[model samples]
Target: MNMLKYPTLLTALCVSTMLLAQKAKPVKQGNKSHTDVATVEYLPEFTREVPAESGSVFKIKNKRYNLEIRLWDQKKVRIVSTVPMGSDTDTLTNDELYKMSGVTLSAFGKRIDLASDEYPENRVAEVTNIQVQGLPAQPAKNRQDANGAEEIVVEGYKTTTKKQQANVGEVTVVGYKKGGTDSSGKTPSAFPNRPVKDEPASIYGTQNPQVADVVVTGYKSTWTRTSSTRRNMVVYIPRDCKLVVDNRYTDIVVNEDLDKAEFTLYRSNLGLRNVNELRVDASFYTMYAGNLGYADLKLASGSLTAGTIDNAQIESTGSEVEYEGGNTLFLKSKADRINVENVGSVGGYKEFGELRIGKLSQDLTLEGKSTHVKIRQITSEVTAIRISTQFADLRLPLKQLTGYDIDFKGDNSTVYSSFEKKEMNANAGIANSESLVAAGVTFGNKAPAAFHVKSDESAGKKTSFNITCNNCTVDFK
Candidate 1:
């Protein structure tokens, strides 16, 4: 966040709304080209300084800079680079820099404010005078100009302006909001080399914007690509610093135990030995770790492998996971495939996924729909079992369930066990949709599908089941 200081006219835009407008003399906004104003120049050699406190945060923002972070005894971060770029400046325009960036405006009157991708979101001399100055002529589609906004489509740009009256309450803005995050944590430039003009619609009059005045500043910047390819960085960071990273597709490795690591990743991969705690919000992420004291993860379309986590809370979609074991596990998943070799206790809900557990020692409580659950062993440490699922499959070994008093209930699901299962309800009417199944399975419109089971022994630990099914054929072995 250490950017160069700018004059009051550059780098800030506010479009706050619902403010009461007032009657003020309208200073006609003048039309001016961005090229006539300030131009930002980037230095080739950049150094980021980290504070020597434990609360210091080191952020890796730009994707062009590839980095490897390692722990060191030094209190401050140190960067080692070979053949660093000379003091020359590389220039990039607002068009290339803010291409796919979202609109970042604050402070708006109760009127229309139109913005388009044709103009830079943070550039100088934009949104000037009548009809947005410096824009090339565009084709008029015979559309009526209403609400003080005139539709004008110029070459490679299309937008509207509404600054005609302070009472303007609505607007049409285009272009600057097309894409999501890129490699860098910043938004890509929304405009092109040829800039466009956006009209403020209305900023004065009885509009009661109520503020002294709405001041939107823009800066001038330039980007010139260099062929040096001198982006690889090796930095030694203090182990005590708390790191918050927004990472892209780079592979990051931390060789030692980290104090704490929290990050948001996109298509990135990471490897860590150990952490005090790790919190991640990611998509398309791949992580490999030795052990974590605690882990809270929300993921989509990726994979996670860890050795032992003391506590794990995860929510995933279409992801794969493999773990050795943990103290406790809580999961909510959809279309995920997970394998846990051993754990103290487990509780979760899933849909259309597969969960395989080698051993559950303490207790197990899970409920879901259309899911496949398999447990190799549920030891004597488990004193209670409460499982409820519909249209789901469950497979458990005979040893764990042998000494328990079980209560099972279902509508149309099948059950198999070592002892004789007392049927609580059988041959009950279910959904009429079962008529599409085998011909002789139903009595006219009613499908004979209800089922329930209870162990005859009343001695051992308690096991309970509650199920409601429609067209669900579950086989419990």
Candidate 2:
């Protein structure tokens, strides 16, 4: 039967006529929500033998079928595909399903490629038009005033004058004039008494508060989110066989262990646990992993949540990473946020955003244009921290730290540390950026100037902090 009978299903199933010739049984699927039933059909299996000298490593390249590929301990390469047809159509022949599927499978010389020209209905994605929402306009209110005299005396201030009342008052002007101290003349000051000298403000490090997430008027914000249908395929591959996958719009899950895997994904989803080496090139790459080692990711956006990464090299437009521990991380980004509970070390260059580390056990070397860094605790094991940034803020724990060294060169920047105002320019009492980050409070300075603060903790541990910044603030308290 033509696919028009099932408009929801974009194309026919994949069933060859050769298999339908024997004991053909039309299986029916129960209707769940709508008038739709399905019949399962397994396509012809494709396999290739590995050469004895070629090391039994199968290479798979797939651009179709959002399949779950599991690495298994198999002798050779094998691929199988299944599709569901409308069970109501018994008269529908197998030849029609095979032609509509456009299946293409080739396995030769340790290389296997399985794909199809046509995809199921669920492979299609739907995106809504760009929507713009804005705040409503506010009407202006009319101003009002109470009726009163033009030069009337206020409650506290009354008119004062010395007059010679000898009936010459008609010619001399002295009826009333504004004057007064308070009801009591003992105070020479005005009725307000100068406002009680103003108390000093208590704030350190960043002077700029975190801007709320608000869109101002006259700004047109247009955005859209893409969604995928629930349709997928399943594929089985040999265990630990090196894999190379590419460009598609589907969810890929590598369930078993893999020694090495490389992928180029666009508008796709991927998930894995342990991988010896993984290289990915994607548009919006988002993944969750545990114990992932040796990863190289270059993408437009990266949102990774991992347990530990032994080594990584990431270059992206934006990032939101939260990891437990890592050996070494190197990255470059425009705007990103990186939070590690504990790590051996971290090194990167960020154009904007924030970096937070709960407890660092090793060294931290960073360079940024405008990135606020908040480190909760720099362990004694950490020998040194080197930073360079502008229009940003840095906070460290100095009150809790023992003896340490600090070499700071701030060009038009402010330092808020020492227990006193002059001590804000002092050293060794406060931290770098761990001031109030946990409460969603961030900071930055608008102006900068030349200033330097140094400390010598020659007796305690050999920990040190060296920073050079412009228009920034360093808070150690």
**Per-prediction count of colliding residue pairs?**
32, 21
As a whole number from 0 to 100, the lDDT of residue 278 in candidate 1 is 90
Model 2 earns a TM-score of: 0.58
lDDT of each: 0.52, 0.52
lDDT by residue (1-477, candidate 2, tens digit) is 677777655432324444453223321212111111112323432232332113334444443456677755664554444444322345434444434334454566666665654333321111111111111222111100221111111111112222122211111011112222223432222212111111111121111111011111211111111123223556667764677877454578878777888888765677887888888787766777677789897766668787877887877677687778778878786788878787787888988888888888888898988999898987778877899898898887765455556655666777776622221334423445232111221223322232223344354676677788888877876
Give the alpha carbon lDDT tens digit for every residue of 54-119 in model 1: 545655442333457788776666553322211222464333332322212111222111111222
Model 2, stretches more than 4 Å misplaced? Answer: 1-64, 84-100, 118-227, 399-401, 419-458
List the lowest-lDDT window of 10 residues for candidate 2.
207-216
Q: Candidate 1: minimum summed lDDT over ten consecutive residues — where?
A: 207-216
Models 1 onward score TM values of 0.54, 0.58
Candidate 1 ranges beyond 4 A from true positions: 1-49, 81-230, 425-477
Alpha-carbon deviation at 275 in model 2, angstroms: 0.9
